[model samples]
Target chain A: MTIGEVRENPAPAASVVRQPTFVVEPSKGWLALNLQEVWEYRELLYFLAWRDIKVRYKQTILGAAWAIIQPFFTMVIFSLFFGRLAKIPSDGIPYPIFSYAALVPWTFFANGLTQSSNSLVASANLIKKVYFPRLVVPISSILSGAVDFVLAFIVLLVMMVYFDTLPTWNIVWLPLLLLLALVTSLGVGLWFTAMNVQFRDVRYAVPFLVQAWMFATPIAYPSSLLGEPWRTLYGINPMVGVIEGFRWALLGVNTAPGPVIIISSLVSVGLLVSGAFYFRRMEKTFADVV
Target chain B: MSDVAIRVQNLSKQYHIGGTQAGYKTLRESLVEGIQAPFRRARKLLRGQATGAAELDETIWALKDVSFEVNEGEVVGIIGRNGAGKSTLLKVLSRITEPTRGRAEVYGRVGSLLEVGTGFHQELTGRENIYLNGAILGMKKAEIERKFDEIVAFAEIEKFIDTPVKHYSSGMYVRLAFAVAAHLEPEILLVDEVLAVGDVAFQKKCLGKMGDVAKSGRTVLLVSHNMGAIDALCETTVFLEQGKVVDIGQTPVVIQQYLSSLYDIADYSLQNRVDRGGSGRAKINYIYLATSDGLPLQQVLSGQEVMIVIGYESQIPLNHPTFKLTVYNNVGQPLTQFDSSLTNALFIQLPLRGYVGCQLGKLPLSARRYRLHASLDNGVELLDHWTGAYSFTVGPGNYYGTGRNVVGLKDVCLVDQTWQLLENAPEVHWSV
Candidate 1:
């Protein structure tokens, strides 16, 4: 008949514990990125990425070698077709080593894009049952790609040794170039994955998008084939700059990343920032629709 | 050090359904609609029919204007029937989904245990999954490590801790998951009906761990249909029905409201209910409870005579038909059954269109709600095995006397028994 009033205690000082308090409410406006909450679950991100890497290699006979083998075989296929039959020029370098350099970054970007795009839907059970920054799911999937990139990079090193190609001062730009590829992958991945949760057509569109994106980049051939402002415009695809930078950094190719690097960096940062906002915007409906 | 742990404003969430927004639509359809949207708007404007009044627009407000608060170190219970917004309220509090309108603010570190071992990888080792599950439930890496040995010891999976959980037996798997969940120390805890799972020992273990959490002075909000647990732990309970709060008061008062709101009349139309099995040759139309005088009965005492009336219509004539009526406890454990095959010779055959009344001499059930399961068959092939028929409630009062009673009543069933003292003692025969 009556609502129970909370009885006030006289000795309230002993029961009051000082701790951090966070409020949850409906989000307003366009941008709702909670990077601090994501940072709080950084260890969870590490464990998730670790779990993905561990599970990917488990029960496979070839194990981590699959990472190297995946990029190696793709490079072989491109060389056999584009180099042997199509006679595509490799900027005065051997086609195998040249294609291998580009494939390393290309495969990393492609894998990161595919995986992170499906990450939210893939972890729907976790999202529905618990609360963490949903950003961790996609970000962790992207982190796992970095491990594969390291393993696949070893093959590029071996191929360079076989061709006796020496590294140039451009090699110093490798880490920054790798980061750009990651940013671009995450940026596009967030868009596709967020839409994928609602429409599911984005799931089928992803592989097609990656395939189309691969050809648009200069993977088998050199970007030097393009002249003038066209070369700069090609950087709009983002991977063009990444692949060209890879070839220039490791093989010391004359086709250096000039205005393309600037364009790629700017576009990738824009994609990363914008994609993050869009992902956060759609995050409100993920538990229901997913 | 705020006294209130959670303050929920007029939180409301609306869900779109049954139209272009009913379920997930493909991108192609959405793109086509996007492309045609402007032209369709123009045509609608020309015709003056743009408001879509002729369309069947559907939406569900899972939670509407729900407001409540729990103070520091206080335990609150939310009780409701299925689809009563109990789970939705918890989901909103845990930040799994944002409200459509209004807001809710939660203080302290919140740990929501809606499902056990969420995000656990089967390919990972038991040791690995413990850490993984702990982290997902919001425990820190160092905290999981500190309790790692205790959890493994509690789960008794130390011998196979390094083995992938896919190889563990289901029992071991749940034990490991529960161990990790029990160790999750948070400032505020939101628990669903996760305790209503596994074997008796596992439930006892969960209750023990929950009691520890309560004793440790943490804020807890539990959503469960188990009134016993709620009554024992929570001083205040909130009753929700049809997406709105019906009452929020002391445990007993709200629980009384919850019970009175269930199965008070012969309300369900069984003919239209789809959750059933077996052939449809003989279908049950409706079911209800009645007294011996054929009066509609809502509830009965522990020792009162009860009659279960089942209405059915058969498509063809049945010879030597078999019928059954079953009683189940509130938690859905089957208590007893009255099968016609045991006494089928009483009647030559069941009628094609009529009511079947299986009368009970005296109901020995305790004071609680009960559901029914009934079936009918034309002698050999099963016709209908209706699993969840109309439900009824038993009494909070006395039973009829002057009858030999059943002994060893396990508190779930009432059995009238006599207690007497013997005047003489018999000599013990101890032959060594």
Candidate 2:
């Protein structure tokens, strides 16, 4: 007999001994987190983040120096327009260092949001071709911004020395504050990236949203300009807590944004959980739509 | 360890076709739809109250309840025409897209190469891209590092390893991409038509590597239009048509089924087919198949007399018209051609509108389905051409009247011959 005939007859025997290792089906409900899958693909996340950093500065003469240039120039512009021209209050600190402190985290947050929001559409080819936790795309994009944040942070340290303003013990909260910025950026980024897959308008809307959000945050002016209840309400924008926290921790400002930070932290966490659920809901359709 | 490598049950995927608000709607379209949505819902509710049924008419089922299973260490080939959901099947199996319904269970780590150079960044160096692409294909960093030199040597681009991939030649780039993919070492490898790229030598190398991969007892699911590769590698093949499994069995059998289905002609129509190219000065309105006796023949026996009738409409009268007709065998290989100019039928006057018949006293073909492609050209300007305009089948026939059937990989023609015994001469040569 031919091999096909022999194999066909033994198919039942072959199937009886089979045990599947992975089963794929339509995702149901909101709890399709699949965190273990992401953890297993962690190396891919690292490589992707590395790729972004490598490709970003490739062929550019300044290389990683562009990271510092971007925020430094923005700080110069803000200091001239808001600090010098408008005489904005710096909460008893020098306005250049004051705004520069907030701008450090603000730049990180803004860059993270812009990159993560467009990550899905930018890597549509990878998403369509391979099978990975789609979350890795936006997450890695947000993480790659950490490189720029670090480069820009070094420049901020140099500026702090130039201004001769030493930070106090509150600098210990810097890591926690940075984590808050990371979470808040990823939270809002997930929603926009997921929507961007379907509606391409999110790509156009993101930069505008970042611009408006900058004004809404206390980067140009201290949160001390407002009173108690209104100030706490303004903390609904997550960057308010992150920027103010940066100023308080780095500049040792006397404003003490206690209630605002608490409210902003809660709001940021809430955005993350809801945004993740929405992202998971739209994840299955990414390959089909994108 | 289980014997079954993959199992798919009742898998289906639906797509909305040409709907104003389906599948990646733009922001403007979404906004417009959002504005009109309330009115649409109200109208739908009113219509439902009247007719008790409201159905949207834009959806099409790309795959419909398709079911199949593949055993471990088996190399299975999926063959189909375009839009047959072959890619869709691979996509669903690879988890690139979730199925709308049903479940596919994979027994091993599935590494899918849907396209080579999937995530290669042009700005990145070749070495960096190798690691990046390997990681994208689910290879661990340690695994990629261990096989790094082997991959580079296999790609034959060791000299350009540190250069940006944008500086590499297209051939070199494809080689590196395919090398990384081939060395992926996943228990189950899913490849989709990626071998169709690169030069002939590279393609041969890829095929050889794939053969080696199959021999090493890894389950491979491949989707390709290359019948030679499929026949050489796969023991069993699945034939899909219109998103459903039509046949799944031995490679040759399933391949023959897929080939014949291309010319099945049950629902085939030449009208309104947009796959033709040329200036449409003259058009073939209809094509007909008939026997020597002038009877329309849907099917004919091998070595029988046949005629192909072509009816045309021309905007202007033509002079010195020539017609060329080519017959392609079951595997889409062009076997023979009958050109009017080559047969000394050139320089004939042609009217603006008339039917032309090309007759053959005896059809020199084997028993198989053949596709017909026809084109008309004048001496100065070409008129029109239609590819795959019609198809017909040739059944088994006793051309020699010996009551013997010619079948199964035989020559595609019946040649008359005489056999003589050389018994007297053989006896004289016994000394040797």
Supply DockQ values for each candidate.
0.42, 0.43
Give lDDT tens digits, candidate 1, residues B202-286.
Answer: 7767777887887788989888776556665677898998778888889766765565465553424432354677788888765
Give the TM-score of chain A, superposed on the true chain A, for all candidates in the order listed: 0.93, 0.93
Highest lDDT scorer: 2
Provide the global lDDT of candidate 1 against the true structure.
0.80
- Stretches > 4 Å off in candidate 1: A1-20, B19-56, B265-432
Worst lDDT window (10 residues) for model 1 chain A?
A1-10
Looking at model 2, the pairs that clash are none
Worst 10 residues of 2 chain B by lDDT: B46-55
Q: Write the per-residue lDDT of candidate 2 for residues B1-432, one digit (tens) a residue.
A: 336678788888876564343453689988887798657654643232211111234667777777777878999998888899999999999988878798888999899999999999999989999999999999999999999999999999999999999999999999999999999899999999887667778888898999999999999999987665776789999888888888888886676556545555351543335356556788775565655433346467776778776766688777788888899887899988988898856647887766567898677788887878888887766777888877787888665667775552578766777899876674455576
